[model samples]
Target chain A: MDKNINVLIVDDYRTMLRIIRNLLKQLDFNNVDEATDGQEALAKLRAGNFGLVISDWNMAPMTGLDLLKEVRADARLKNLPFIMITAESKTENVVAAKQAGVSNYIVKPFNAETLKEKIEKVMVHA
Target chain B: MPDGAQAGPDEDRIEAAVRAVLVSMSGDLTAKEAALLAELEALGRTIARAKAEIAQLSVDDITGAHIPSATDELDAIVDHTAQATNEILDACETLEKLEAEVPPAAAEALQGAVTRIYEACSFQDITGQRISKVVSALKAIESRVEAAVANASGRPAPAPAAAAPVAPKTEGQELANGPQLPGGGTSQEEIDRLLASFD
Candidate 1:
């Protein structure tokens, strides 16, 4: 619920990035940044003082799940709150994301309230 | 196919029979086809298994190979843009409301921000055209795949699922819509229950 906490939003689709950024603004999240994919997201996360990562599940070069795995593997980023955004809520996908240590997940086309709730859940034990 | 829908099965059968006979008597055969008709019938039977496997695949799968699920992605893109258009409009309204409450300078800034947000909605035209392009590409593949299917099945290929007369899409279709509107995907409760069951 800390509006000041820096968030890194990553998606290959510009529209999705804009949509999520706008949604985050509605949620009163001012400290937000974006990247086009996991590779760039990882680089930004490494360079910045981000407290959370909200990423789309699919992308080229590297996927959000790959970013989650890499984040979990990196000693410095292992505990950062990661909220995965998936285009499908398949059982296997949920299990895979959960197993990879995602803090929470939001199905795409989410609204501000959903973002708020998911961020709250992740923040509780982030 | 729409033009030839009235063509009877007998006509098709006779034509196919003639074509099969001609192909059978052809002097030139590919190395693989020649091997299939070797001294024993086992080779032909062995090749039949592979052909059967391919034949069993759904028409969509055959056509899908040429385009990697672009149809679905394009559909999603179209749907997302429509929804995002409304979402952005709502955002603009919200910013406009905020403008009234803020200081004059901040209000002007808010108005400017709203302009930028509205401009971003221009993604609609480009995205719509992109979706159209995807549809066109899919249509081309559909034509080719249908011909292949016709050759394989020895009948006119039926119209693709997309081109089929519009009907009430099934709940199965709704479920298949990946991360669509709210409640389109598996609920968080399901994931939680799954995790709890594991414990």
Candidate 2:
């Protein structure tokens, strides 16, 4: 299930997106696509089938939290696993994400190991 | 023991009356004292409570009114300070850009001047060439006339001249020579017309 998962990576920074994509590839998740923001991500998600979503919290147009809420509300995408990557560590933000039905949360500046651990955790529960 | 024990109804009545009177007066005094002391304690407590309530109310009022004003003043000061700092930063940036822009513009102007001077020097070269050609032609014509004169006289023609000589002349010689026209020169208008054709 881990190796065959279709992952969608969303981030505004090109460098960060490449790094995350590389990390996911290293973890043997070969099927990966990228989007720059929430709106593009959602468009891609609707256009294609994706098993998981990894996204940055802060972005223009639509934020990651908003995307998470939208994904959860959608009948088709409600069961999809969504992991939030962010620099913000406020308790209320985390609580709100949990309430919004986020699969998991990972703080930013994370390495490949942290990404793997988070993905594995989400996948196991999912 | 008998003396001490000797007592009757009148004596008993007198003793009972005295005991009753003492008990009554003592009970009245104690009750009055207790009531007064209780009242004093309650009044003291009430006054202390009222003082405490007044102090709390004053504190609440002052904090509620004064704290917001202080906060607002502080916020305004901060905002003004930030705005001033931004303005200064903007001015500094503009100055830096101006400083950077100035030298290049000056350099460009200098370059343009040098280019113009080069063009003028080139034009001068062309004029000099034209003048030299005219002078050579004039010398040729002069030599031809000298030959014709000698030939008609039937004397041996003077030694056939070589190409026109280009020797450095003294200032006195140059003045005496007048302006040696290049081959007795073409008109200025013809030169101007030639230059205009190039243009």
Candidate 3:
């Protein structure tokens, strides 16, 4: 995995964002940015050069699924690696995210090892 | 009244009797119609009054009082847990920085302990999501009450209070309910298996 790639983490919860950032730091990924919701995330994704997107599913105004759909629809961002981290463990959620073209999915309350593993899986093909 | 008609005392008496009966029947019909209309108006008023009472109860007793308080308390829980989790993370970071100064065996133990603490802090996220689900449920109830009131009263749903919580953005959001309670939902391994099938 490229530890130097610019990663954007989108979550409405500040604590979750901080936790993910720290976990990424532990995995040796120093470049990380954050957006609180999908709208802000989309703006950041469009304005900046982001290699990967790590987003939570539920948010106000716009959701991670909404973000994924937007990314997939955009010509420039369609191929960008995306991972969804959410507390929703339903089968439909996973299928919907997969249909939206997410690269990987992680259930919440995950450890650094799980985060590393998912990142490696997605970035290897990126 | 016809061109050829017998003019007799009996014929004139029968005509007068028929006129009297017809007039009485017409009067009865008009009175009955008026009574029915009045009853319908009263029924409408009663329904409107009932709907107004229900709306008041929903807004004043439930949404205005209990629901907001409950949601606020849940929000506070998330806030407090987050604060505590950050403090724990801070301690762990401090321990990490001090690892070099500690003896090697103790340093190894400390590292393992810190890693566990980091993992344990994730409870805050899970609990926070669960509380959010509850808040969402409460909001749904408030919406239903408003809808019922509007339908009964033949008026538009009243706008929620300025301080009232906002609804989720989409149907998918409600479907994407956060983590399930114990004994429910797919396990992580099962989820992974399901994802593998998609491949």
Report, to 2 decimal places, the DockQ of model 1. Answer: 0.32
Residue by residue across B1-199, what tens digits does model 2's lDDT show?
1221222334335445544544464434577776755554454444444433333333323334544455555556545544554454344334434444568777556434433332222222223333444555555655554444343333455586576986664221221211223444323234324323443
Each model's RMSD to truth, in Å? 13.5, 52.1, 13.9
Candidate 2: which pairs clash?
B134-B182, B134-B183, B135-B182, B135-B183, B138-B183
lDDT of 3 at B105: 99
Q: Which stretch of 10 consecutive residues in model 2 chain A shows the poorest summed lDDT?
A: A86-95
Displacement of residue A74 (Cα, Å) in model 3 is: 2.3
Full ranking by TM-score: 3, 1, 2
lDDT of 3 at B42: 55
TM-scores for all candidates: the values are 0.54, 0.39, 0.71
lDDT top scorer: 3
Clashes of 2: 5
TM-score, chain A, candidate 2: 0.95
Point out where model 2 deviates above 4 Å.
Answer: B1-199
Query: Of the pair 1 and 2, which is ahead by lDDT?
Result: 1
Q: Go through the candidates in order and give each one's DockQ.
A: 0.32, 0.01, 0.59
